[model samples]
Target: MDGIQEFNPFSAGGLDQHNDTTIPISDRSSQPAVLQPSQEPTPKASASAAQVELLRQQEELERKAAELERKEQELHSRGVSMGPENNWPPLPRFFPIKPCFYQDFDEEIPVEHQRVCKMMYYLWMYHCVTLFLNILACLAHFTVDAGHGVDFGLAILWFILFSPAAFICWYRPVYKAFKSDSSFNFFFFFFMFSFQVVVYIIQSVGIPSWGNSGWIYAISVIGTNLAVAVFMMVVAGFFTVSAVLSVILLKMVHGKYRNTGASFQKAQQEFSSGVISNKTFQSAAANAASTAAQSAFQRN
Candidate 1:
């Protein structure tokens, strides 16, 4: 110890020498460090690991339920109700129904009246053309005999009897159909048409007074080529068909009339008490008046 050399650290008396036995913290810092939980690197695996599976299952179940609910909603919205009574869309008023005895077309309709009118009009034209052809064919008989086939008296009688029948059975019913939506007119047309069919059959068979023997299918008729007799029958047959078709058209129009929101309350009233004062009727009339006014306004 006496031989130890003196430190030449610039003869510094600032050197600390108070506790040589105790090592300084910096000199012996290799001891295992006490790690703090807050300072440690976080685990890559989520801490919510246990909850994750639960959440996934919950979400999956929720999605399944939502899908089921969505399917139900879609079916409901697609105009398809699931219940027995709710299985179909609303039916239009123009379903398989009989013709109305009265018609009042002034309101919006699910189906257009114009379309029905066009069908009827076309049929009418077809009937007219057919009638004309038939008449011309029958006239051939008269042409062949000239004076003897259908004399003036016979012609006058035929015209008188048949013309009135045509008007009453066919023309009047058609006229009613055009003027109003009437079930009676429709029935009239059907009835008249049926009668005409019988007449046509009679004439086509050449049953003497009705059908022509000069035109097509002349072999079926009784007359050979007597133009007057043949022509008159053809004419009569055509008109007979016309009468029947007039009834059919009347029925069709009547069907469309129901879709028009037309009410036969007046007719009902007439049938019931010869007058109308029911609330339903009063409101209906008011609505009609309002609708007409609005239409007029829009037109203006």
Candidate 2:
């Protein structure tokens, strides 16, 4: 009793203290942590990149479409509209002779055909200039040798005749052919232009007594008058250049014609149709028939 006398209710034993102790949160930290599953951003990142590429492609296509639209607008502005005013022949308002033809490369000719058509126009101009220069050269020749007066006369005659004739026969036909895509006009141009090429070759050759200031006449005059001969030679060179250009242009036109689906049969058809549809032809036919009827009635 004396040795165990100090045990009281306020004092706790070791087993009782152990039974009341609680485990701390840090004690469980070493156990494998049960974390919520995190989503991988790789699929989302790839999807965003794909969307960005698609957007870039779409923007590129839009830019191309805008560029094409701009080009089309420019082409339209270049006189593709209907009923555009003609600016060719560029004659002054006060001139006695008005422009007879309505010529506009942008309005009348297709873009692909305009270049060759313009070249043909320039060739015609060159041909005119060559003829004028030939006349001058022939005049000089005549001044040196009065016996060559025939060449001067013929040169004047050729200048007067061939200038208009070339324009009407070959140039106009080709112009109309390009303007309307007429098979008959194209064939007519080919025929006339072929003859023109031959004439150019002849003129370049400078045969004696011919109106042309060709190589032969130029060389002949060289002994008599070197100044006149040099001048004539220069003109002869021009004729040669004209001939070469004519040949080249002829081939170019033929190539264009081949692409036009034109044929001899089509040309014939176009000719017949054009003749039938022409007001002048119809009037002439009617007058001829009336005259024939009157003659027959009187005979009866």
Q: Name the candidate that leads on TM-score.
A: 2
List runs of model 2 lying over 4 Å from the truth. 1-88, 288-300
TM-score of each: 0.33, 0.68
Tens digits of lDDT, candidate 2, 1-300: 777766554557644666557577787768676887867768889899999999999999999999988887887899464444555577998988766667878878999999999999999999999999999999999997999999999999999999989989999999999888889999999999999999999999999899999999999998999999999999999999999999999999999999988889999999899899999999999999999999999999
* lDDT (tens digit, per residue) of candidate 1 on 30-81: 8788875786445644556757888999999999999988988999899655
The deviation in Å at residue 221 for candidate 1 is 7.6
Tell me the lDDT of model 2 at 121.
94
Model 1 lDDT, full chain set:
0.54
Residue 54, candidate 1: C-alpha displacement in angstroms: 79
lDDT of each: 0.54, 0.91
Off by over 4 Å in 1: 1-111, 118-135, 145-168, 171-180, 211-217, 220-300
For residue 259, model 1's alpha carbon misses the true position, in angstroms, by 6.3
lDDT of 2: 0.91
